[model samples]
Target: MAICKILFFLLALCIWCGKCDVFYKQVGDEVSMKCGVDSNSNIEWKFNGVLILTIDGKSGNRRKGLSHIVLKASASGDILKVPRLETRDSGNYFCRQSGKQHIVHVVSVFVKPGPVLLQSSDAELHCDITGDPNKEVQWLRPNGQTYNEKNQVIHLKSVTSNEAGQWTCLVKDDLKLSVTLTVVGLQTTAVNASKGDDIELPCSLPQSVFQRVVGGTWKAGHLPKVSFPTLTNTPSKILHWNGKDLSKVNFTTGQLSTNFDVTLKNVQSTDEGTFVCTVEFDGEVRLSVETTLRVVDKHSGKTKQHLGCTLFIRTLSFILYGLKLWIWIAVGASSVFLIGLIIVIGVVIQRNKRMKKRVRKLRSMRQPLTDKDYCQCINSSYNNCYSVIEVLQHLFF
Candidate 1:
């Protein structure tokens, strides 16, 4: 029975140790690894067959552990801690308990940064993964180059302009990483500013490469160099281009301004030209982008945009005026119709009352009062009371 028990324990050990788990950590982070179970007999940790830590309870064997490592015993389990983990810490760590045929735990550590590395130097992209036994990785660069290897990192060195694109990393369904590598350098995006308003001639560089930027310059057509800076530190330059006075250019005052973009203050009509931006960085010069500065008269009303806006306003005003006229005409016509209807109704009501009064008076008198006094209608110049037109002939007869 004891032999069978020993065999069973060995089988369990083989099974548990066969299962390897992946744990990801960057270089400077603290990591805690659990032994999964606490043994009363002995507990030991190893890195690639090298004995790292041992806790012996039976014979009281105590040994010095790795530097910067702390072993913690708790109700849950035994914990191995690293205060500040390094790149060398990346490997398989084995934890074992004494008299146990099965391994307690297997932890595989990896060191790398997060995705999307933007830098002036070479970029290193990482594929974060866990729970894969094969530990295989596939990499695809922006230049359509492919790599299939066990390594999880793709180191790109001496990157150039055309190399700026997407990089893909994959471990099938278990892991995947997509990263964009943007090599920051000279470039221009168009912007519009009024003649008198200030403008920024764009030249942008990443903050990580700030040391490489020696200086920047701006020029107008083939004329003499328009602007150059006196200072070594700041990105701004004093205007010297054209026959234009240097006093007109002002350094936009800021202690920590990033953009090398120049500002032309109180711009005039002569300032219109194809302005070019040339930047010198890291002992090399590159011409970046050109902006067309078209300065017009400062008059507010005559500009093309203002004219289009004014025409739109006039069209809208005419529509509103026509609508108002139609509405007023409809209202006046309705009022006239309403007044005429009211007058006709009042005349009918008065005629009905007079007819009723005449019937009652005739029944009471039983004699001819006067033809003119029996009925009254004032439709015309005639003032006779018996003025029913259909009965006028009978009354006369």
Candidate 2:
């Protein structure tokens, strides 16, 4: 009986060692592998080629373990179980039966994080990672503040002058990775001024800050570096003087002034050039803005007066010429009408005289027949009679 029991145990061990199989499956999926001792015969299961599990009334040592997953094995030999598989669960696994051995599986799964935008007004930065395991993300500010939030995204609420600096993002996992986020500030206003006048160019800050005026310096036409002196009780209003002599330019208010305003008294035409404003802050000189000053003569007033006078003279000349043209036309028309009237009058007078002479000649041709008619006709000589008749006719007509 003892020998028979030992032989039965040896036969069972051989059957359990003979069945081994391995295969691959995706994460969050069911896993199953065939375990058989012989053809048309069920067998037990072994994990990693050593431990065994029984199936179909066969018994063996049951084993269960996990690398990065929950491993579960039934007393049944044909199946090995894994629950809630992850990226780290991807690896070699083994299954066993009677006398056959096979690699159970090698699994590979992928997972990726969403894209994120790290942006500023002057610069753009991005951070992304792709793998089976989620990556840890971090961001560092120029002020030495570290941010390690797990939202797959990070956004700056608003960019300010103080936020203008280098930023870094660190991704930690099986492999460590890093990216940079650069935040730059935007300039809202441009600097400008006129020559021979007091000018105050303001450098705008973010709206959050209460103070409107910030500290800044002046650079003149690519000249050498000159520090901006502090404002004091005496000559503090003038930031810089570019004229011939600094002593002549009055700055009783000292060098620096509040409100970033520069005053120039008695500014001259020669003090015209480009001026650059630079502000030192946040451990370095960040921004350099430029403006220009030009001295121009006040000729607009004179030009306007001259133009007004010229227009008045032109208008007067036009009126006079129009009047002269009208006078000449009137004189010409009167002369022509007068000459025609004189010729017509003379013709009419000559016609009347001729008619009178013809009438006298006709009268002279007539002969006297009776004594009374002869006496009436002999009252004057022929020429005298004709003249007297014409005179009478002229008076009567």
Candidate 2 structure quality by residue, lDDT tens digits, 55-81: 343334333343223344343335456
In candidate 2 the C-alpha lDDT for residue 34 amounts to 48
* Deviation from native of the Cα of residue 303 in model 1, angstroms: 1.0
On TM-score, the leading prediction is 1
What TM-score would every model get versus the actual structure? Answer: 0.46, 0.25
**Which parts of model 1 are misplaced by more than 4 Å?**
1-38, 46-53, 56-66, 71-86, 91-137, 141-180, 183-202, 205-211, 234-245, 253-257, 283-287, 304-397
Candidate 1 on 1-397: residue-level lDDT in tens? 4533543444455467664434545445555666665445567766544567677756656575553333432112356665455544554456765222222222223222222222334555666432223345777767878864557655665456665777766555543455666665556655444567666666555544433445556667634544534224444533222223455455544432346666767776666677777655552434366877655555655675864565465554453445754566677899999999999999999999987887666556544456545554567745554435535444333
Error of 1 at 58 (Å): 6.5
Pairing residues by index, what is the TM-score of model 2?
Answer: 0.25
Worst 10 residues of 2 by lDDT: 109-118
